[model samples]
Target: MINQIYRLVSPGRFEITYRDMSLNGNKLVVRPKYLSVCAADQRYYQGRREASILQKKLPMALIHEGIGEVVFDPTNEFEIGQAVVMVPNTPTESDEVVEENYLPSSNFRSSGYDGFTQDYVFLNRDRVVPLFTELNNHTASFLELVSVSIHAIRRFKEKTHKRKETLGIWGDGNLGYITALLLRKMYPESTIVVFGKNDYKLDYFTFVDKKVLINDIPQDLNIDHAFECVGGRGSESAVDQIINCINPMGSVSLLGVSEEPIEVNTRLVLEKGLTLFGSSRSGTVDFQDAVNFLQQNKEVIDYLSQLVTNVIDVYSIKDIDSAFEEDLVSSWGKTVMEWKI
Candidate 1:
C-alpha cells in the first residue's frame, strides 16, 4: 500500500512524501488519531541536535507519541475502529534478562526510522495497546510520555534505597510534572517536592507536598530520593542539586534528554552514595501499565487533563508547521495535534 508520510527533510523543513507500506502477514494497519509533540521531536524539527546527528537522522518522520485507530487487522485481533496507542520501540533482538528498550538492536521510531507521521501505520499485533473510547485524544496522545515516567518509577523501585519518604523532582517541565504526579500516585505516603524556575509552571504542581524555586532552595533542605527531569545544559545543575540534597544511599532516576554530554559531580555522588539510573523510551508492557493506571486513577486523569494547553487540528502540512511553531514558543503544558489527515 502506498501511504503519504510527512518527513523532516532538513532543519525546520518538512516534506510530504509517498512510500510503499508492505502489509506483511500478522501485522495491523492503524490510522493515527492524535499525535503529541515531544521535546525530542522538537529537537529534530528545529535542527537543535548536533549537525552530524541531524544529518544522519533527517528525512525521517517526526512523531513517536501517538494514538491510532485500527483500520485493518488481518488476524482479527483488534476490533476495527478501536483506539490504540502505538508503541514506537521496535526490538530486532531480545535477551532473556534485558528488556526490549535496553537492547542495542532496538529500532525506535522518530529517531532513525519513520514514525507515526504517515497516513497509515503498520505494526505488529504486540506494538499497539487498546485505549478506552472515552479517553480524550489529548490525554491519549501523550500516553507514551506517561509510560516513560512509569517505566522510570518501576526501575526506581528495584533500587535498594535506605529511604523513600521524601522525593524531590527537579525541572518544572512536562516530564517533571508527569514524574512527580506518577510518584504521588504510586507512593501516597511519600512527600513529593518540585523544584523549577518558572513560577507559573510550578503553580500547576499544587498536588505536591511542596514547590520550591531552584534558586530559592534552602541550604538545609534535603530529600530521601530525587529525580532529575531537567535535561540539556540545565541537567548539570539539576544533577548537582540532586546529589547535594539527596540523602545518603538515595536513588535518583534520570529522565531528561541531552544532545551533548554534561558534567556530573561524581565526587558528591560517591560521598552521598547516590545510585543514579537513566530511563529512555518505554516498551509494550510499560504502555499497558500506563493505560491501566490512567483507567483506574480518575483523579490523575483529571489533573492530567489540565496539561493540554494547546490543541491544533492538522489537516494540511501548514497546520503541522503551525503546531510545531506554537509548541516551540508555548511557556507551559503540552501542545497536541489532532491528526485529521
Candidate 2:
C-alpha cells in the first residue's frame, strides 16, 4: 500500500511524499491518532537549528511524540485497533553495560529519520506499548516525553544516594513539570521544590511543596538532589545554580538538551564531590514503565491533562502547518494534533 508522509522540506513549509509499505512485512503498522508538538519540533519548524544541521536533516517527517492505533499486526502480538504509544528510539544492537537509548548505534525518529507524521507508522513489535483504556487520548499523545522523565528518574534513583529529604527541580516548563510530578509521587516523603524565572510559569506547579523564584532563592535553601530541565542558554546558569544549592555528595540529573556546550562549575563540583549524569532518549522498558505508572496512578492523568492547552484537528497539509504555527505561540501547555489527516 502507498503511504503518505507529511515532511518538512524547508523552514515553515511542509510537503507530502509517497512511499510503498508492505502489509506482509514483519513490522506492525499503526495509524497515528494523536500527535504532540514539542520544543525540538518547534526548533526545526522555525529554522532555529544550525544551517549545517538543517541542511543535513530536511524533508523529514516531524512528530515523534504520538499515540496510534494498530491497523495491522502480522504477528498478532497486538490486537487490531489497539491504542498504543509509539516508541521512537530504534536500537539495532544491544549492549550489556550501555542502555538502548545510550547506545551509539540507535536511530531515533524525528532526529534524522522519518517520524510519525505519515499516513501510517511502521514500527517494531517492541516499539509500541499498549495504552490503558482509561488513558485520555490527548494526554497519551505525549507519552514519549513522559517516558523520558521516567527514564531520567530511574537513572537518578540508581545513581543518587538514599538521602531523599528534599528534591529540587529547575525549569517550570513541560519537562520540569512532568519530572517534578513523577518525583513527587515516587518519593512521597521527600519535599518537592520547583524553581523558575517567571512567576506566571511557576504558577502551574501548585502541586509541588514549594515554588522558588530562581533569582530570589534563600541562601539557606538546599536540595538533596536536583533535576535540571532548563535547556538552551539557560542551562549554563541552571547547572551553576544546582551546583551551588545542592547538598554535598548530591547527584544531579541533566535532562535538558543544550544547543551549544554549556560551562559547568567544575571547581564547585569537585569541592562538593557532586555526581552529574545526563539522560537523553528512552527505550521500550522506559515506555512500559511510563504506561504502567500512569495506569496504576490514574489521578496523575488529572494533573497531566492540564498540560494540554491546544488540540487541533488535522485533515490536510494546511492543517498540519497550522498545528505547528499555533504550537509555536502556545505559552505553558502542550499542543496536540488530532491526526485525522
Candidate 3:
C-alpha cells in the first residue's frame, strides 16, 4: 500500500514521502473517501511547535479529520461497503501509562500510525466510526471536528446557564462558526454573537444570525458565555474581551489551542467570579452524541454545508500546497479533498 508519510520539518514545508508499506496483522485497509483540513494541519504543515514535537517523537499521518470506506475488512466491525468516521487518538502499544477520561488508555491513533490521506491505508478496527447514511461521505468527513465543537458547546452548558443568555464567540473561523451553529440548536432562544476582523471571511458566516466586528464588540456588553476559537499568538485579546464582557459568574470555554502562552485578565476572572474551562477533542460519549445529533438534525447539517466553500479532488493533491498558501492568506470556510476510488 502507498501512503504519504510526514518525515521531517523544514523551513518552508513539512517533508513528506509517498512510499509503500506492508499490510499485515489486524490492520484494515480503508480507501480514502474525503478529507477535511483543519487549522491543526496548517500548523503542522508550517512546522509549528506542536507539529514539530509530534513529527520528532512519532510518525503521524497528515490528515485527522476524514471519513473512509472499508475496502478490505478482515475485522467484523467493518463491512466491505461501509462508511465510517475515524477517531484520531488511541493508545499505542509503546505508550506510557496514563489515565484518560475519554478512552480506557491514552489518546493515540493518527499520531502513532499512518492516517487516511493515501489511496489505501491500514488502520485499527477500534478507531473507526460508522457514519449514518444521512451524512454523505463529504459531510461525514467533518464528524470529528463537529464532535469537537459539540463537546465544547456541551461543556459550556454544564453550569446554571440561562436559555436567553447572550453567548459571544471571539473568532470567526471554521470551529467558531460550527460552535455558533451548535449553540443555536442547544439554545434556540439565546442571542448568539460572533466577533472577527475580516469582513470577507465573516460573510461566509451568514448562517450565524448575529455577527459584529471585533472593534464593535462592546467593552461592557452583557456576555453570558464566550468561546475563544482563534488559537496562536494575539489570542489573548479574545480572552480579554470575554473577561471584560461576561457577566459575573458567567462561563468561558477555551476551545482554542494557543501556540504562545497568552496572558488572561486574572483579576477580572477572580474579581467577577467567572467560570472558565478548557475543551479538547470529544470523548467517546461525546462522539456518539454528535453522531446522533447529526442524524437527528440532518436538515441543519445540509444547511451547514453551505459553510464549506471549496472541495478539491484528491487526485489533485498537488493543489493542496497552493490551497494552503491561499488559505493562510485568506479563507472563509472549510476546504476539503474529494476522493475517487
The prediction achieving the highest lDDT against the true structure is 2
Clashing pairs in 2: none
Q: Write the per-residue lDDT of candidate 1 for residues 1-341, one digit (tens) a residue.
A: 99999999998888999978777688899999899999899989888888889888889999999999999999888899999999999998779999999998999999999999899998988899999866787888999999999999999889846467899999999999999999999889989999999999999998899999999999999899889999988998898888889889888889888767888899988887778889988999999999999889877987888889889999988899999999999988888999997
Please tell me which predicted candidate would have the highest TM-score against the true structure.
Answer: 2
The order by descending TM-score is 2, 1, 3
- Write the residue-wise lDDT of candidate 2 on 141-236 in tens digits: 999999999999999989989998999999999999999999989999999999999899888887899999999999999999999999999999
Tens digits of per-residue lDDT for model 3, 226-321: 889987774888898788888888888898888788998999999999888888876455667888998888877875686566777645445556
Better of 1 and 2 by TM-score: 2
Candidates in order, TM-scores: namely 0.98, 0.99, 0.84
Once fitted onto the true fold, the runs of candidate 3 whose alpha carbons sit more than 4 angstroms away are 1-27, 50-59, 92-113, 159-164, 207-209, 316-323
The weakest ten consecutive residues by lDDT in model 2 span 324-333
Score each candidate by Cα lDDT. Answer: 0.91, 0.94, 0.71
* Higher-lDDT candidate of 2 and 3: 2
Global CA lDDT of candidate 2, please? 0.94
